[model samples]
Target: MKLGTLVKPLLITGLIIAGPAMAAPSAQQVLAASPVDDIVERYPAMMSEGIREGLKRSPQLPPMVADTIGYVVSNSFRAADIEQQIVKNLERDLSGKQLEAVEGWYKTPVARKISAVEIAASDPAAWQQMQAKAAELGKKYKGTDRARMFERFDRAARATESAVDTTIAVQLGLATAMAAFSPDSANYDELKRKIENQRNAIRGVVEQQVYDSYLHTYEKISMQEMGLYIDFLESGPGSAFSKTVTQSIQQAITDPIESIGNQMARFLAPQK
Candidate 1:
């Protein structure tokens, strides 16, 4: 699948979008707050990076070709459009308290540290050290506990589910785009029907890739730290924040994924 083309219409949803006005702060004020702005600034770059990585995995595609296509499509992806969608959602659903909670937690030292690690999780330099540490730590815990810890870490980082879902969405987009753009002589419905048969297989493959990436990303983060992060995600404010962002993102992508998945064989990203 051409990932760049797939994510071209991805409307990024997040926790720090514009929310209601209350005693805590106005929607505009929340937008101006720290960490909120920080995250907002990062999404465009992240979106571009994510698409680039996805394109790099296309079977037999030349690096330059993939890079060029990814770059062009990502460049055309308007951050403003995404923000507007987020704003619309936030305005309708999030309460002032929820907004403040997101802001407050992100302001915390622990949250800052976690976010920094996450932001750098894809970096080569950081991965070298993190992976080495993860190897050491993996041996420290054995059996059931280690397995349990792995699940905790993966969920906290949203590694497995998000990746799998995103890939599913992208692949569906590819199938849809292919059908939509095909010539009059082409059988779009026939192509869609063929894709439908492969959807489950693509999902299964994507799930495996997600698990591998999760294991790698969490390699440096200690089990104890993972526990704490898990706690934060399950906490009142933390849970609210995580759920709000996750739900919004899920909502934004779910339609496209279902639309495409219902028609095309999923475009499976090459496992890293």
Candidate 2:
């Protein structure tokens, strides 16, 4: 999906993961309080540069994006703890696919992709093209308040894409860390399978939590959007069209998350 489309949904998802307070501290505070400081302290040479780079990039982000980065950093630290749990509980080393899966989680692929898009969006020509396309879509769906709906959809799509990327990064990162620290001496394939199993289990839980949080946030946003749409419809000339477009946008916003939950459930199912 287009990057603009995913922004809102991704932001909504990030907000959900961040919880009600959503009170992530500034980059400075995060640097001080982050558990990764332990890792950095231990492997100063290996990690300090990367941490600094991440921090440098952190300030370039929009406030919402910066908060999401904090969430990612916090989650990465938590993944380390979970890795220790896996080592203790499973009594086996992580390998291959399993390793990849865990490492995927913290890598922030979604954010990276959005970063690229934001760059593209910055170019005047590219920005104009996007607006032109949006206008065309608006015209095509005329009389249905399609213009505003199109904008929301474009934003939501970008957000969803980013969220999915972030999800993958977190999974992969967790898997990699688990493998590095695991004590068992199983072969790569066996280790990998076990790691994948564990990763899948952990991801299933994370996905469910994220999904629930997203639904709650979506409900609130949808209600506000609907209320505003109704007000426009009542006072303005586009009431019926506005309602139809709003409903359609809500469905588009929800369908992907629902599908993602279903897909995750399949992976999470009990192995008989």
Q: What is the lDDT of residue 257 in candidate 2?
A: 30
Task: Please provide, for model 2 over 90-207, each residue's C-alpha lDDT reduced to its tens digit, 9 standing for 90 to 100.
Answer: 2223223332332232134532332234334433344345544544443454555433443344343333433333444333333332333335524434544654566556555544
Q: Give the backbone clash total of model 1.
A: 3
Per-model CA lDDT versus the true structure: 0.54, 0.36
Clashes of each: 3, 40
lDDT (10s digit) by residue, model 1, range 1-272:
78876565453322224322335654445444423334444554554565556656765455675565445445544545445555566656668786677666666676666666655554534545654665554555446564666566566646556655555555554544334333442354565566657767876775555544455555566667667777867767566555555555545544444454333322323324
RMSD of each: 15.0, 25.6
- TM-score of every model? 0.59, 0.22
Q: Highest lDDT, which number?
A: 1
Q: Per-residue lDDT for 123 in model 2? A: 38
Candidate 1 regions exceeding 4 Å error are 1-22, 25-65, 122-146, 153-159, 176-222, 250-272
